[model samples]
Target: MAEQTFDVHVEREFDAPIERVWAAWTTPDDLRAWWGPTGFSCPRAEVDIREGGSIFVTMRAPDEWGGGEYHSVWEITELDEPVLLRYIYRFTDADRNVITPAESGVPAEGIPDEAHHEVLLTAVGDGRTRLEMTEHGYTNEQTRDMSRSGLDQCLDKMAEVVSAQPR
Candidate 1:
């Protein structure tokens, strides 16, 4: 039998330069400004931009959306300033305790404990930057679809942030 695979690829072009886009991702303050979906907010962000460093972020849902927080961690595997970033992502609790998808109220049928995600940034000339994000290792199609939708919304928020910047 063949193995099943699930992945998501999202790409977008920002009016801001590559440096600005990279800062938005590496700077905690800039990241918190637009790290989640429209109705979600990033209350905290801690980033260490290095090959072996880690990033932790707290995403909080609106009052109407259960009013809880979800913590996520990214173990940086590779970093090339303003160009490429590779990491493995995992969910955690408020105390930084690693948690499974079921523990976080997510269906656990095919969701892996950790997934590899990567971001590629390119200078598209004329002060524009192109970002390509890919995340994979999902065990089930449902989880992948849901994650893709949420990621799309998050990227939309990021675009809004980039657009408001002083070019």
Candidate 2:
């Protein structure tokens, strides 16, 4: 029997420095500004941010889109200054209790829970940062695509947020 794997990888270039890009992900205020997709709003942001710590976000959908909050926790596995980060993404309840994909209204197959993620950053010239995000181990195609779309939008918003900040 072969195990199935679905993965997502997205890359973006920011006009800001690698430190700015890293701050967008690590700072709670910056995270709250652009944590979700285009139509989604982030209402809550909390972080510990060390190698064994976690980042938590409450992503709120718009009222017109059937308002709901999706809570997520990223358990940090590795932290390397402004260049790299590794974490495990998980759905969680309001109290930050981990939930399975099914419990989170995700239609998953052949997997119980969790996705491993890595964020890589490189300085391009003096004031640009090339960023890459990789998420591995989705259970199915549909789930992977849905996640990818959200991630893309999040990065899009991140670029905007970082660009607006003074370098």
Candidate 3:
């Protein structure tokens, strides 16, 4: 029998150019400005925009959302300027120590040890940019659904951030 796998996908269009949209994602300061859910905040972010690079981000949930910090790292696997980006997401400690989801306050059950993410950017026309994000490797539907919600919220925040950038 085949194993069950779940994935999360979200897409959004912005009024900015592809260059601005790409920079908003790859720049650390821009990431910190709008990396988490609506009520959440990213207090730390470090991005190395190259193949085989790694990114570190610290996200803090609001008091109503458990009020804790979650540290994560994204191991970049592929990169295409202003077009495509791919990485593997994993939890890590503040000091760069790898940790399990349980240690990071993330639900362990139904969550994969490592989630794969792929982001594609396209210029739709008239300086508009379309961003498509996909995250896979979930062990169950519940985890996938949860991630989908988070991703959607993150993009909603991204829309505001990118739209404000000078295009």
Candidate 4:
């Protein structure tokens, strides 16, 4: 398999500089404030914002659906401050426990070393940053279908998080 994957792309024109936008991502407090969809909040977070660092967070819904914990262990493969950040993200529990492919619904055959995840933050003209994030290694048809339905809402939340922040 050619590393089947699903991607979510979000581009927003912010009235902020690239450095400030980068801070929104690298700073733990700023990240927690706007990491998810609108109205959702992260009451807990632990992160080390450096190469080979990790980030763990719990997303809580404002409504009564309750909230589940999810985590991603990232190794900053490439970092060009305020320009780009490339990393591998894996699913995990609230405690930053890694979850295997079987548990993550990804078949072993499709998993690639670069299949975890790739998030690219680029400085588009007009003072905007284009954020492209992808979650790969999920070749299973059912899992992909299920995730597709929820992705837009998730990205919307992420955008909302960014919008709510002050430059």
Model number with the top lDDT: 3
- Model 3: residues >4 Å from true position, as ranges? none
Per-residue lDDT of model 1, residues 9-127, tens digit only = 88999988999898888889878988887899999999999999988999998999888888888999999998999999988987778998678765577778899999999999999
- lDDT (C-alpha, whole model) for all candidates: 0.88, 0.88, 0.89, 0.59
Error in Å for residue 40 of model 3: 0.5
**Pairs with steric clashes in candidate 2:** none
Per-residue accuracy of model 3 over 1-167 as CA lDDT, tens digit each: 86798888888899999999998888898899888988999999998889999889999999997889999999999999989999999999999688988888877887777888999999999999998988988889988888888888888888888888774
Order of all candidates by lDDT, from best down to worst? 3, 2, 1, 4
TM-score of each: 0.93, 0.93, 0.95, 0.68
Lowest lDDT sum, 10 consecutive residues, model 1, at: 101-110
- Model 4 C-alpha RMSD vs. true structure (Å) is 4.2
Of 2 and 4, the candidate ahead on TM-score is 2
- Model 2 is weakest, by summed lDDT over 10 consecutive residues, at 104-113
Deviation of model 1 at 63, angstroms: 1.4
Distance from true location, Cα of 136 in model 1, Å: 0.7
Best by TM-score: 3
| Residue-level error in angstroms, candidate 1, position 125 | 0.5
